[model samples]
Target: MIEKIGNAIKDKNKSAVLLLLACFIFVFILPAIEFTSNMLSIFLFSLIIFLASYPISRKVMFIGFVVILIELATRATDFIYVQYLAQLTTNLFIIFLVGSVIRHMMNQKNISIYTLVKALNGYLLLGIMFMSLVAFCDLYMPGSFNSSGNSDMELVYYTLITLTTAGYGDITPQLPLAQSLAMLIAVTGQFYVAVVVAILVGKYASKN
Candidate 1:
């Protein structure tokens, strides 16, 4: 069973589908279950390791798994430093995975549904990466956002909103760092869209 699962994740298209499912659960479903709320960071980190297994090196995968185990073991202690490390690690892992996805998309000779799915996965991963950053800022620096008692879901919503450049203004960033992150998220989102579109169009044009 384990080997089967590993093989499924080894395929780019299959792994993209799995990542999308995990992202949907993290964003939409997990928040509804009250007990799972605090596990958000760990869940995201686990996904990082799982998705990284195929594209990244074995050494990186082992390191990520070790970090996840450490985070789980120390969950009861709630050490501020440990939490910071976990969040930072999660952000870095997602960033690397996103880069891998982009490189894979660019290297594809033909555009197809799999290519489109990979592009979508990359976009969602960007939002997830920024969400981790937002959470890190809020965790270490209280009052980073104007809203009080911000839930994980609320943070996810705020990140997506900022990523999409919707600017609803419901949950505005308070601190300078948070404000800067918001701008970075919006710009990164637009840049990803432009790059993906260009790659797809170029592939299509070349095929003609």
Candidate 2:
């Protein structure tokens, strides 16, 4: 079984596999589990940092490590501004890193299972990153959003909904900043799908 798993990973792109794992943890596991602890958050952050760093440059990886440490350190602090700074910087770095990975995948000019996986990972990561941004806005301005729950999982769900332009209307952003961010998230989702899907589909078509 171990050998089989190894072969499967080898068959696909390593980065894609890692990204998928991170996505699974964020989308499925985190939401399913109750009473998420700080330890769990740290573990999840570590896993994601590991997953995301492999495909990036050493310098980028170093910066990511630093940001993660900052987040871990300040996450428990009472200072809201400090928390926001860490979270925002970490999310921004991740967004840039994932975008870089997507660009790298596109440059390869061959569409494979891993390429598609990476594309999906990029999309999911966008939702996660923006969710953090919205959460940050919430930190400074409470009730920036109206939701059934204010947990991280709920925020993630809302982020996905906004990204897909579903607009279920259950969760509404109240603050102007939240509203603008939501709009930007929707537009970004549309643009990413249109542009990235076109490139990948065109490449696949040309290859065949």
Candidate 3:
């Protein structure tokens, strides 16, 4: 699938570039739009899982989407509490897609992984950056902004702190919106760390 996309780009297929760009732009739109937490959760999650798995395997991706929907209905609505995580995940998927394309392009240009890793790393780091950005954008998000922690910057810093699980309690949420965000960060952060680290460790062990 990636190879075919690469060929299309190399051939300067205008339609193909536009299609990819459209998908790429969807990432930014989800964050910028003011969606209620409930609405955002369903829409964004479905969109992201669809985008990620669609290229590699449509059937498997469909199954993944169903599983996520079920999870949302049955268990975890915390996802909606901090829709920023959803936005960040969407942006991260876009970053990964863009990186994959750039890697393919560079591969054509015969660049080394030694050089490619730098770009890959930069895109991955954008995940962290986007998390911070989403927290800021929520200030403008349609939901009620509970003016907690004095300023937006303070809230962002605290969001990062909660996300990293560094709960020193210098700042805390006094409002429902802020508390929900904190809860989202705490749970989401743990899940993210556990899954990502487990995958990396599993890969290393298998490689050994």
TM-score against native, each model: 0.83, 0.86, 0.36
Candidate 1 regions off by >4 Å?
A: 1-7, 32-45, 74-79, 204-208
Q: Residue 41 lDDT in model 1?
A: 50
Candidate 1, lDDT over the whole model: 0.75
Residue lDDT tens for model 1, 85-203? 77577567667767776786778787777677777777877887787788878888999998666456778889998988998999999999999999999999888888776678667
TM-score of 1: 0.83
> If the candidates were sorted by their lDDT against the true structure, best first, what order would they fall in?
2, 1, 3
lDDT of 2 by residue, 34-63 (tens): 555667766776666656666666687688
Worst 10 residues of 2 by lDDT: 6-15
CA-only RMSD, every prediction: 2.8, 2.7, 11.4
**Residue 33: error of model 1 in Å?**
5.3
lDDT of 3 by residue, 23-114 (tens): 33333344344344556545644554454344445575666565555544544466564455554444555445544443333343333332
**Clashing pairs for predicted structure model 1, backbone only:** none
